[model samples]
Target: MHLVTGGAGFIGSHLVDALVESGQKVRVLDNFSSGREEFLSHHEDSGRVEIFRADLLDMNAVKKSMQGVEMVHHLAANPDIRLGTEVTDTDLKQGTLATYNVLEAMRMEGVSRISFSSSSAIYGEAEQMPTPETYGPVMPISLYGASKLGSEALITAWAGTFGAEAWIHRFANIV
Candidate 1:
């Protein structure tokens, strides 16, 4: 089974739809903080999609949800940059800690592959207008960016140590 965390949000909901259309069994783990239930309502009748209302910050809940899952698409996060500043721990809890829980869960479950939705914010104030992947010293000015970078590091370590494969995607502002 394929697990899509934050599968009720905009990007995640669309990803779930595409996965469902491809005849894959999908499970969703979402807290609904930024995600809406209405987004997955259409798939309620499909039987191919299973929904679990849970926060990624809860490691036990994330571990429970990972049972029998072969792959994970981790999308759950505090997407608002402004909120990260006001709520100091928002990015840490949602981005870094949540990612740690997911990786640990995957390790315990023996799941081997993971796809993460990271951001270009990790590049921070780039000396180059359009920073290339080979750019040096990625200094992130925002809490959100730092959190993403932390998650990426954890994922890389998990992949190397636990024999898992990870695809870390650094996305630019598409929306």
Candidate 2:
């Protein structure tokens, strides 16, 4: 089974849909901060989907969700960008630190593969429009962007140190 964090949110929910349609068993761990239950309501009885309502900040919760899962789609994060500006610690806890918790859980559970949801914001208004993934000297401007970049770094280190594999996607604006 594959575990997807924030599986009830916009992008994550659609991911769940596709996974289910493809006949893949998917388990979702979501705190429901901005994720609506309606997004996943159709899958409640689909048997291919299992939902766990929990926060990634709790390492125990993350570990529990990791049980018996082979891969993780790490999509959970604080979605409100403006909130990050007002609260300095928001991204640190919800984005960066939460990713640490997920990585640690995956490590202990022996799950080696992770697909992290990074963002184009990590490029931080680069001089090169339509930047490539190999763009040098990544500098994030917003707290949200910085946290996502930090999470990407953590995933990279985890992959190298633990002999795991990771796919990081730098997504552009949803709309």
Candidate 3:
């Protein structure tokens, strides 16, 4: 079984579709802050998809959702960068703290593998057009970017300390 956080959003919902097509059972944990249920409505009858409407900030809810999960696809984050500026802690709470909860819950549940949806914003104001993977001196210009970098750090730390498997994919703006 696969667990996808923010699985009702555009990208996450599409991922759930692909997973279901591959004959895998998926558990979707989403808060609906930005995720729309209609995106995942197609899967209602399959029984291969289970939707858990909960926030990642809730440790108990996160833990409960992690039950019997094999792999985790963590895509939940504050999608609005401008909103982060208005609410200073938006990114910190939604991105960093939420990621921490997921990792901690995973630790307790003994779920090792996690695939994180990171962003190219982490390489803020890069000198090059397409920043290299080894780009240095990452100085994020936005709170959203900083939160992503922080979440990535946390994931790496969890992997190193607990022997967990992690895949951090830094996605660029789509078209």
Instruction: Report the Cα lDDT for residue 144, model 2.
Output: 94
Candidate 3, poorest ten consecutive residues by summed lDDT: 166-175
For candidate 2, lDDT tens digit of each residue in 59-108? 99899999999989999999887899899999999999999999999999
TM-score of every candidate? 0.97, 0.98, 0.98
lDDT for each residue of candidate 1 in 54-146, tens digit (9 for 90 to 100): 999888899999999998999999989889889999999999999999999998888989999998899999999778888869999999999
Off by over 4 Å in 2: none
Give model 1's clash tally. 0
Clashing pairs in 3: none
| Candidate 3: residue 32 lDDT (0-100) | 99
Give the count of colliding residue pairs in each prediction.
Answer: 0, 0, 0
In the range 1-175, model 3's lDDT, one tens digit per residue, is 9999999988999999999999999999999999999999989899999999999999999999999999999999999989998999999999999999999999999999999999999988999877988998888899999999999999999999999999999998844
What are the candidates' C-alpha RMSDs?
1.0, 0.7, 0.7
